[model samples]
Target: MSSRRLVVMRHAKAEQDGPTDFERPLASRGRRDAEAAGAWLASQGVAPDHALVSAALRTQQTWESVASGAGWTLSPDFDRGLYAAGPESALDIVRLVPDSASVLVVIGHNPTMAVLAQLLDDGSADAEVGASMAGDFPTSAVAVFSYDGAWADLGEGTARLEAFHVGRA
Candidate 1:
């Protein structure tokens, strides 16, 4: 099985007031933080070949800023399911990714993102990283994992947490 890298990120801070939750836009701080997140991922040598992003306005803007900051030129699939997804639903979406993608990025909302990160972890990776993730998975936070199996086989305790970061700018 090929070693695959999964970069899971929570969308950056969004304005509290909007026409609807799905229509909310990223705040200025969110844009800056997301850019920083992208830069950080790039410094860590994470280059995603495929990206799954929520179709929400905030998520779309976050992805755009992240891609710009990372100097990556690619389009991501704006998945509507991710907008209302829980941890399990998000995992199901990931399972659909083709084996050809060695590195994948998923950007979406929290709770789901945090829970998914926790669920995927096998507790065999860096203790500090795991602990940090457990404490708080705030906006702009990212969890990177490495899995040595097919995407279809990804489940609870199937991945090793490699890194965790929260972008603030």
Candidate 2:
């Protein structure tokens, strides 16, 4: 089986009072949640080989907090396209990942993240994993998928949901 891991994360909680959505940063709760999620990833030995993050301030802050806590060594890529991307756009970014990488993480917003998770998951026993993701990829949530083929070939049934975790639950 191919060993490709995709870790998708939703940015942590942000101040609702911000002047604009893009300028909002993580809240205190968001900081704690991000740290918790990051520590969990570290405990699972799931350090990402590469990270692609949305350019939004909240998303960027979430990535930085998690990466710092995870002690990640890889430099992350900031992609503006990921900010409010749809499932196809998310898949497009994933398809660009080099097969040489064993793990890749994408940190972005919701609705899209939820949709992408559903698109990638096959109706296997792991359907529950996808269901969990559907419940809502709230702030500081991470969903993990294992693809049984090359990154370039990733799509639909080619990927299987492995785990879904959220900061609060």
Candidate 3:
């Protein structure tokens, strides 16, 4: 049984000061929430073997804050594809992860993150969690799924939604 863990999250709230969307930074509340998200993951004893993050400023800042708060040493792979990518692109990215990584995290924009999480969730027995995740994904919200397949084989209906975490607002 080659079980794997996938964590998909939308970047925390970001500053509106940037001239362009890609240049926007995390807002004050975003920083705090990012740390809390890390703390919650740590409390659950969840540590990612690798992180695939978006290249945007806010996304990078979110991961940095989370790693610092969780006391985790994570080497992330930042790709532009995740910036405003759709669910299929997101799934393709997950499939590209090495098989050695048992746990992987992806931090990026919304809509896509939300769609990817919901697509993988399938009909997970936990109806409530599944419904909420598929409904809406807020800033700093994480959807954790367990997959019983290889990364290259990742796709819709192949994973179970184990839990969803939302940092303090």
Candidate 4:
């Protein structure tokens, strides 16, 4: 009953055929998707007390759209390590979140986000999330998990997947 919610969101759709993947900004569709996703989260009353975001342009742009649409005022922590981080790295970042925050959001890339969601999910709810882990996480996707303990105690099986949302149909 820690009341801590972890909202992990994959960055919005990014432009393709850029000079480099890291430099690619969010596409026009990405902005709309991000706005929709943020609005949806707001409707759920899932505003983040804190946010950790990747430093990539697409990720930053995605965060901007979501934060603006959600009316979020918390300053986000932009981390370079999150760009291509593995599941363990992502978990480490989550563990570092302050206990004072009732909710935290992480905006990052795929494969790692998908892996972290699968690893942390307890299967009590959202069976589809486990099955979907094998696939790639689309842009503006969110996986929400609730932990019974504090953020410092967050670990594998400590959380249960509360819900999952994807921007695309």
Best by lDDT: 1
What tens-digit string does per-residue lDDT give for candidate 4 at 23-94? 899999999899888887887789788899999889999889888777887889998889979999999988
Kindly provide the TM-score of model 2 when superposed on the true structure, using C-alpha atoms: 0.91
Best by TM-score: 1
lDDT by residue (tens digit), candidate 1, 1-169: 7799999999999999899999999999999999999999999999999999999999999999999889999899999999999999999999999899999999999899999999999999888888899898999999999999889889999999999999888
lDDT of 2 by residue, 13-80 (tens): 88886778888988988877887888888877797888889998998888888877777767889999
Runs of candidate 1 exceeding 4 Å displacement: none
Report every candidate's CA lDDT: 0.95, 0.82, 0.87, 0.84
- lDDT-wise, the better of 2 and 3 is 3
lDDT at residue 88 of model 2 (Cα atoms): 90
- Clashing residue pairs for model 1: none
Report the C-alpha displacement of residue 19, candidate 1, in angstroms.
1.2
Clash number for candidate 3: 0
